[model samples]
Target: MTASWKNINKPSSPTTAVTAAQVANGPVIPPQQRLLTYSPDEWEGFVEEWAYYCLPAKYKYVQRFSGAGDMGIDIAGFADDKRLKGVWDNYQCKHYDHALRPGDVWVEFGKVIWYSYSGEYAAPRHYYFVAPRGAGTSLSRLLANAAKLREELIANWDKHVKDEITGTQAVPLDATLRAYVDAFDFSIFDAKTALQLVDDHRATPVHTARFGGGLPARPASEKPPQEVAATESRYVTQLLGAYGEHTGSIVTHPSALSVPKLKDHFRRQREAFYEAESLRVFARDSVPPGTFESLLDDIHGGVIDTHDANHADGYEKVCAVTKAARDMQITANALITCTNPKDRDGICHQLANEDRLRWTRS
Candidate 1:
């Protein structure tokens, strides 16, 4: 059993945009909803949803538990194909507003151990700790230490377990339990179903079941919501620029580069280009370079901005920059051997404007 002495709070779900139809129909829910409500229970649901969605198709089905009289296990079930014997697992969810202390994990671990020994269908093959909002540094460190100890025990279980009659080896919960605790998108059971489960599982507070004991104070490093939004906006702008440049260069003619041609080029090569570049840039800068052909395809295919294309002012700027750069490159190549002063002066002015705009936008 993995235990920690941390407050088990929940994450709040954000307000979702409702359509006219949904309003008339009394709120039609989408498949994957963003978590606006932050609570330990809601966070747990988010984790379960993530596991269900991101985990391989094999790990699809999941079961959750909450409420009074329930043992330490908040979720128990299997993933993978139901046809083939599924992998058994259990989950413990914690949503701490404050940083999770080392002792929180210790307590959770003990409860898991007890639940394994005494609860219904107790000892699953695998277990998990699903903290959607995130676990504190202290809790993370303690879990790491517990994992090491669990490994040692598992390696020498025969020697550790005293009773030969039971034919049972010592099983450390940490050795078997996995942690699906991180920040990302997720989708699980419906919000209403999740809320009902939480209400049903509201039982005696388990905050004091400490083994290692006491919450450790730590500085919060979580970013504010506004900062996160700003970061995302900056990232999207860069992505559009890079995408425009790559696509424009690929499609433009040396003599007559047109906007229509640039858009057409993006349509043909967006997917392959995106696939090739997505890993490198999106991972680091959150900017994805889209090809000219791809951008056009997005526009024609209605995949870019569903609203007015004018709303994507950043994309327009990037396109203008890319077109100017391509033209400048062409003119520069054309004037490489020019000896006429009048021609040279005229070409320089044109090049200067292109350079100025390119620099300004980029």
Candidate 2:
């Protein structure tokens, strides 16, 4: 099951423009109600957004064509280059006010045939009709039988398809075109119900962003582990050398590690070292994973700013510097104990911002 808080912390719905009826009525309609009255163009965009996130990530190039000139396909998906040569599938979005009947599919079927016959694009691997309301029972039974769908299309051709499919020209299905249409793979065509679209949409990442569904951005309580290894040899050497300078170690050889005074200092330093190390882990974990690399890049790009008005005053440059230092210490102290990185910056800034950076000691 999805880890969404459905009741109290339910994800918010996408915002839509208020309808005129809603404005005059003094009570707003639900978003779901707004969807029922979407304009033709709006339904196209809805299907496009749905196809974009729901399609396999490898498609990478999903696009919607502008109206009228798009030769039949409304939404196109390509695996590589952004053209018909690489086009893999197409979604035809229809937002009828009622359930889809077999008669409604006539013009849609004609456009696909005429376009394919004229070599505008090859027959798509999958051709889906995505509508708000799903197929009617009559159409559903007809869709189950490919041969029956063909017969129904040919039966309704002149009345539903002929003049509507071609704007200025009358293009009747000749004997050759009729044979081609019958032989064409009807199984490739499918109807996506509104319920199906809703089901898939509810599981998408966008759904979480649209509605506060995912786990709260709270940081983990347990500190990240600090395991000192050869990778930290430079620090270990500097630390042990600094200890030797303070305590005056005379011991040489590898036995330096066993020197009593040096060992005691090292013992005391362990807690502090790991405590600082935990903060580093906390900062790294604060943002979405892998953003620390971006933070480093931003720093390399010279995006760091030091003049925090709250922390520094310009009475003297020296005074500002000392104030900043004190601010750093306070921020570091709070950051070190932060169990949740999602909490505010004194806790730890998740990302590097030009106005303010959350980390103090780093």
Candidate 3:
């Protein structure tokens, strides 16, 4: 049966021919061009998108708020599906480019606890600290400690001891205290699980965000001010400064052989250079008719070859293919010509292997 299936799946012959009817249907979409644009806003948008996607269809009509700054809460809304009665969840999104610190964990957890207690709706039956990136070790430890304290409080209560309430028991934290700590193996609650809880809860189709008090929507004109752009710029500058310092040290101490670090740096540089050159080639080749010729002439006449000599073998091949693609007027960076017949056959086989790729234009 497998042999028959393989025979049936054999690649078709490759021929580059376009009919007027095929052209009229539409120009082929390039893979890179077809890729969805990922803006900074969209980066955090995934938390909401995934939350909504994982949610049961009944819960789909819930109101969604992104970047909601109720202390640490990034998202707040209710899932109004009949199956999940009074189902709602608040999210504390940590868009961290770096590892989360203990302070972040304390702050967010504190917010969840605070909102649960003081907010008009009183307490959400289900609660979560939805950190998309995950929490740091220190933060995880803090959560563990909070969980331990909750356990101790419950244990003491069971034993008919004094009703001394830990800070967590005051309001919001009291309601979610049990689940947050008991649901996970605290020993293993790394940044990954901190983020995974949001999805896991959704998979079970649980709704946690419950509000008793009516909360008015802040108008678009009255939305809270965000300093994200300034913050991002500052972070970038700091990162660039750190990179410059490391690069300076590396240049001064060439004998300091950190093979892995050096290799990673070169690998990233190669990838970036390849992408930039590919984009340049793509833009040059995509110009309307006569303009491409002038662009090509300018590119060919340029001194870019001096840097090409320093490139690795794979990168050299990529450069060669890019130039060939530009000359051939191929608009895709993903399409590469194979010199060896065996390699070409392999490429065809791979392309044919996937059902989705069957209609893809090479």
Candidate 4:
């Protein structure tokens, strides 16, 4: 998730250009309906997003395989260090004009069983057939009843699985292979309906951009902890140095500030820093990558001149820079809408933490 919330929180469906028939009928195709028109590569890309982004916490790693000799592994999600040899799952991407049927995937079943039996890789814990049109009614029933699915596959082995496993040679179901097939678990095979895929995809950062749905609501920002966190050390030290410069003494801590007003300001600054930190975490879970960094760049560009201006003390410089940041016109970034004035202030401190901004001419 990135800092920017540009595409999120908008309408779930954007209005597309209407055709003559649609104008006359006053009907618009829904976003998911557009999947049927997608090319093979586009469909695979959608599945890839669903697998990798939507299930990050579930799978240790997700990889997409292409070209020949892949052994029917379109996408594999590893659960542990053992990778394919250990617990894993597979997502098979299929983009056809119609819904997937039993006839469409018997060979795929054979490939998985044969390859795993040959020690090429362990059989997946779960195998999902993901298609644009989803699985047909007949196939859906077979998948639901695992025994029926296995029976059909074994019965249709010669016609669909034997000659279809590879072009170079036919993989005959001999006595040993037949025994292996009988013991294999067909319960792991299933299908994800198109609607389910779309629903799950909503959790990913790319969903809004790909489907035109607005982002989910932003989570509430967390309050700062009572103790100063170690991550705040650099910026806090700089602020204390600025305060020291103003008072002509070493201001070691916030409690050391004699002026009540300065103490309040210090506390407020700490709160603002935590606010920005919360926003950074929000961006990580909600938006695309680099959103928060880009917002920082915008704030840095807006406040640099004011920071460089002459001031009687470093405190004045800090105040002026943060104020300028707050007042800065940020019409370009999508994150501007969700940001508060204090977030702009906190972002300055964040920049300082990275040595990108400074106070007291240091």
Best candidate according to TM-score:
4
- Candidate 4 lDDT, tens digit per residue, 1-362? 57777856876664677666455645555557978888988887788778888888889999888878889998888999898999999999899999998899999999999999889999999999999899999999999998888899999999989998877898999999999999999999998877888888877766656764445787777777777789998999999899888889899877789988778888889889888998898777766788778999999999988988998898899999999998989975657768898898899999989888887755
Worst-scoring 10-residue span by lDDT in model 2: 341-350
Which wins on lDDT, candidate 3 or candidate 4?
4
lDDT rank order: 4, 2, 3, 1
Instruction: Estimate the TM-score for candidate 3.
Output: 0.31
Residue pairs whose backbone atoms clash in candidate 4: 1-283, 1-284, 2-287, 3-292, 8-215, 9-214, 9-215, 10-214
TM-score of 4: 0.84
**lDDT per residue, candidate 3, 51-125, as tens digits?**
554554535443445543444444445655431235555554565554466534444443443444445343333
The TM-score measured for candidate 2 stands at 0.59
List lDDT for all candidates, in order: 0.37, 0.58, 0.37, 0.86
Candidate RMSDs in order: 21.9, 12.2, 24.2, 9.1
Q: What TM-score, computed on C-alpha atoms, does each candidate reach?
A: 0.30, 0.59, 0.31, 0.84
Worst 10 residues of 3 by lDDT: 205-214
lDDT of 2 by residue, 1-362 (tens): 66656545757774988765456555654434555788889888777767877776847688898767787889988876745755578888888888788777788888888788777777777788887777788878877888888888888888998888867787788988887887788887888886677566655545433322232243334332344455334444444444444445632222466657556544444443344344456544332344334433332233234423333221122123223333442221223234321222211112222223322221
Deviation (Å) of 316 in candidate 4? 1.6
Candidate that scores best on lDDT: 4
Write down the RMSD of candidate 4 (Cα, Å).
9.1
